[model samples]
Target: MTLLSMYFLAGVLAVSALAVDFAYLLSARNQLQVAADAAAHAALYYREQHDAEDAKVKAVAIANHSMPEDSYGAVLRAEDIEFGHWDYDSQTFTVDDFSKDAVRVRPGRTETRGNPVAAHLFAILNKPMWDMTAQAVFVVFDPHCLREGFVGDKVVDIQSNNGYEKGFCVHSNQYVSVNSNNTFEAGTVVSMPDSDEIELPRSGFESNAGLQAALRNGYYRLRILNQMDRIYEDLYWASGDFLPDYIASAVPITVSQKKLTNADLIPERVHRVNCGGQALQIEAGTLLHRVVVVTDCAIRFGAGVILDEAVIITQSTDAKSINSASDLQIGRDDACADGGGAQIITYGGLEVPAALKFFGGQVIAKGNVSFSADAGGIEGASVIAGGTISGTSNMTMGYCGTGMDDNFTVPYFRLAF
Candidate 1:
């Protein structure tokens, strides 16, 4: 009877040990999974800033510190890191040397026989260890680039007197008002939250509040602009992710910005910059690779003003004037001519010609983007207004993908499933 009791006690002790060891293994796995997630995101961010080789180096470095030195009882090595694409259809990760969009990482590589979680009491029964693993995948996307052609928080009014070309997409969170005299080209989309309220000129609404997630959330891991004015500061640095190709891909301009005091820049200069976010006059037929930042000031355009390879940012908080009005004034109605497009951003209200044409740059304002007269609207341009885009007549916005090295795109990163 005493021998039987001893055997029962031994069996109970072994079972308890096994349970304790299993808990430890689970904790280790959770730790590894967290490390891999952080590492994968860091790798993708690095890839955008630098080359692929530098990206891999950064991924491994971040993974090594995510878990404690003895958390998993093994140091993370470079072999565990992988550069690849996350397949949407197969729900798998595929290795690729030239992969740019996605990154994959495995902190505790337990696929092989040797890299297993060492067991405690289970080992006494010849079940010495068990395999444990965790992995993470991350992908990169440009929020500003990979989205609808026209986006408005309140209302998206497509009251063009002319017609919409193919491949045009318009989105609004609140409402979409399509006034009269508008023709919907084949494959044009008008997305809004309340699909029933959508006013279509010819056909039915092609898209709806699918963009609600993007509008409400900033999911990208890097280069996000929460405020409307943040876009201006980012133009100075490539890390901010909105620098035009003209400046980023150029041979490093000795000067990126110039200071101007309500005076027009000389058009003939090759690459002159206007800094200090001061107000300036962009005369008609002005051509140069320059950057203009306007702060707490107003900008007037002499009729027929043209900006080539240029950036214009207006930063005004609340109201710059005593009368509660925006300090920025764009172009006059009769005196209008433009080409080679410009990048424009304003924190206050903006007033422009009713009929406009821009060869593709960014135009964002905190206040209303109103028109002066009925005219042919924008072509190859992105117009974003915090308030209403009040205008009528014909307008054509051809989505020009990264044209003339002057294209600017906002980027972000996040875990992809």
Candidate 2:
């Protein structure tokens, strides 16, 4: 062949070799990216359960699937070309030791290089291999969604189990109106804010006219229609007994006069505190130093958890202070001595197991406060015996404050994932 013809042929061959190498690199890069993406998605599924091991296995499996394979001889064949040293596990070039053709699949990150293709005419020019690399990162997916309201209807239901009547004392700055037609029985008391003209269900009251007149004149009526509607919707979601099985099965609870020395005042598993006996479970516990704070905890009563001190406060704010005359604060007190600030005083729910005898003190329920027992038989923390829970024409119950109101906010659940 002529010298000029030879040179031309060599140039054409080199160009073709470059094209093949470039195509293989591109294909390999695409595959690597796909593998990385799939691996990341799979890792997210086990992020909360398995962590790193699960993620690594899933990534390798995905990478293997992305590569092309053949049967029998199992040669790396693609585009009518036979490639050598395509070791996926090592992700390195088989032909050239220093070649850029390699894939490194690591936990969290995967790196890959294009296939190794020998140059035809370029081989004479000392060009043996073309190298290409791609990298991909894995991340967990996160999304935010808000949940609100109670799980079901009937936020509060007062029933007579042993021929005893029940009642509630609802105190609120807003108007109180019953929306249900359920009977208030013969001795139910409903209170409200103002003595204004109000309507009542005929079946709920024998003295419908008297009840309306009292409500109009700011006299908290003994019976209001559908009073359960005024309760915060979240109150219904709380888990625990509103009344204890028996009044005498309560355990005594004591608080020291000095500040609490430990972060965990009660056992971790003690989710509920029941006082169901004649004696008050929580007696004359002094708050001379920092106040007793119950956090991430529950104070349940059997039937007779009495409060020796009427000055007890259930403070809901982070500062932990009594806001009103009837307010009682529970949870950690950051201001108290030796306050580690480690105490988690946030309770998801609160239940009154039985009639709570409160001499004084505010019951501040940061979460939901449920009262499902009969009103007349037992004297609850707020309700008196046979007094009939009388509220003004506009009495309110449940969490009535602003910002994430009880009716609008739902309890947060601890998901496994």
Candidate 3:
């Protein structure tokens, strides 16, 4: 062959060799891209489950699955792929310079680039293996999402009986306002606004016997005097050292009454009580200590369960504190600071199986607060209710009142794919 012809042939052969290498690089890039995608998805899944180590292992496994495994060096070559976090602004990834010989995966710093498959296709003429790195990101699912199915009432009214205190007292971390025509008393020694406005109906003192009878007869209208009023009420009467003559001429009147019953205070454990097959009954004076964790459980009371402490009811557990004559009090405990010290945290919704009779006490519902019964079933006696009622699609209500019409401003998480 002539010298010119020989030179032309050599040029053609060089071009052909470049094309072959380019095709091989393209195939490798495509495989790497597949590996990266699989690794990223796997890592994300693991993070959602709160398992970081497992996530890494799964990611590696996915990378291996997407890599070639026919040759003796196939497994080793696939292991060269690295996975990590990519910082966009930093313009880098967890793995700065990964290669078939150096397969070290970096933590908290992964570089993100155009698809690995595209990179391989472009690496035909120069550069070793392209930058084929994988990254994963995940966010936790907020428990708040579980609160999206609550429905209930807001305003409640409790009438006063002879000398019985009317209305109720409420303490909340959120805003609370009273609109009912009743008296509100701060049960504790600490004086609160509007305490004086809430007083007994006739005598302005609690008629224990009459109140008991009313409760038993299902007539929650009987009012009791707000004894705590002495600290706040200016009209309180105190007759002491009556003139000697007037005291001597007075006749003694016979007064008989039944003793008040103390509630069963159960400490930090789960208890199953009957709600008269109505909803779930928690008799008055019932105390739950510690956190009462429940699962798909319902607590219905004949009168209502007086929660002197915090009660947490999750989706796995359903809790209902329904009373006929008194308000369902939650988060009241001696350990509680200035407030009633009781907290009712619900991951699920609250159902007032009957008319809620709010005699007294505050409610802090983190979930939805709902009333299903009519006046006959539920009545808003002298009660102060507040808390967020969340139900579906970022929807929330009454984060601070008895009604489910307010919005919640608490921080929450969102689960994603």
Candidate 4:
């Protein structure tokens, strides 16, 4: 009986030792995985602006910070950081040094780096040590609705006879309300947080069969709106160099008295026009090209005013920060083509009453945007508003996949794997 008791004690000791070794191995692997995840995220974030080498350096530092070299023994190397593109369909990462979309990181403790986790009692089972490698892939993505469309934080109300072209999108964080006789072309999307929350006519779904496609889950938050102040500061300071060519006026620049012509903008493509809380109205038949007008007052585009390759910025919070009459052209070329596009960035709302032909350009507002004119030449033009988008009718808007770099884009990072 005493010899049997001794044998039972020996079995219990062996089991306890195995448990300790398994727990230690798991803890080490978890630590390595945490370091890899953090490093991948850091690398992708820095890669947005820096080169590949700089990104890799940042990743290695992050990994080391999480798991010190003394403890982990150089778990991460600069070469272990790879720049790549994460394909959603194939769930694969293709290495590309030029692409800044994704980053892959490998952090590990292994025999190769002389950091293999030594085992205690597992050596009795011919397992002297354990090796672990943790890999992480981080990617940046942009929502399609924000790229080229009419996106509103509040309601998006459109009247009848309006035709949205292919690739065009309209999304509202709250809800989207539309009247009948509107055409939503194939490949066009109108999305809200909830499809049942969309306000439409009685035959809304039947009339617009494409409305079914609009029933997508989740709402896209406009992160760019929060960064507008920073964006404004950058544009404002960059215009300081060409201050001498500013519109020389303390009062408003109106058509009745002081009208502005192309001659007012000279030598440079950017200019600062401070109206001292007054209005800045361009004269009729004036053609401004490749110029940026930064002002603190409201802006008015006179009849037949062609703003080709131009940008108008207003810092006013007035109800109508930007207004235009009939025959106001914003771009000079095709919507999908590059170059010769105009943009209007307003702190308040934008109101275009009639015959506003805009192409290959973008209108971004901190307030509501009302376009009552026909949507001729609206392809490649994005109308984004912080508030509601109403008073629109008989307009057609299409998406321009390329040549829209000027459009405000907010990129977000996610762990793909």
Which is the leading candidate under lDDT? Answer: 4
Tell me the whole-model lDDT of each prediction, alpha carbons only: 0.55, 0.29, 0.32, 0.78
What TM-score does candidate 2 get on C-alpha atoms?
Answer: 0.27
Report the candidate with higher TM-score, 1 versus 4.
4
lDDT of 2 by residue, 154-248 (tens): 12122221221133232222333343323332333333345242233344434232233222222222111122222211112221222111122
lDDT of 3 by residue, 154-179 (tens): 22222322122222122222222222
* Candidate 2 stretches greater than 4 Å from native: 1-20, 44-47, 68-104, 107-265, 270-417
RMSD each, Å: 8.3, 21.0, 21.8, 5.6
lDDT of 1 by residue, 1-417 (tens): 999999999989878887898888788688778888888888887887587778877877787677544554443566676777787888998888677788877767353623567777677788777777777888876554223255565676766454555555566556677655565665555566666666555533323222222222111221222444455555533325565434533222333333233243432222234434554454544443454433444655544444555666655533321011211222221222333556666676556643344555555666666543323434455556566655546555454444423444444677886
Q: Which is superior by TM-score, 2 or 3?
A: 3
What global local distance difference test value does model 3 have?
Answer: 0.32
Candidate 2 lowest-lDDT run of ten:
143-152
Ranking by lDDT: 4, 1, 3, 2
**In candidate 4, which residue pairs get closer than 3 Å at backbone N, Cα or C atoms, i.e. clash?**
none
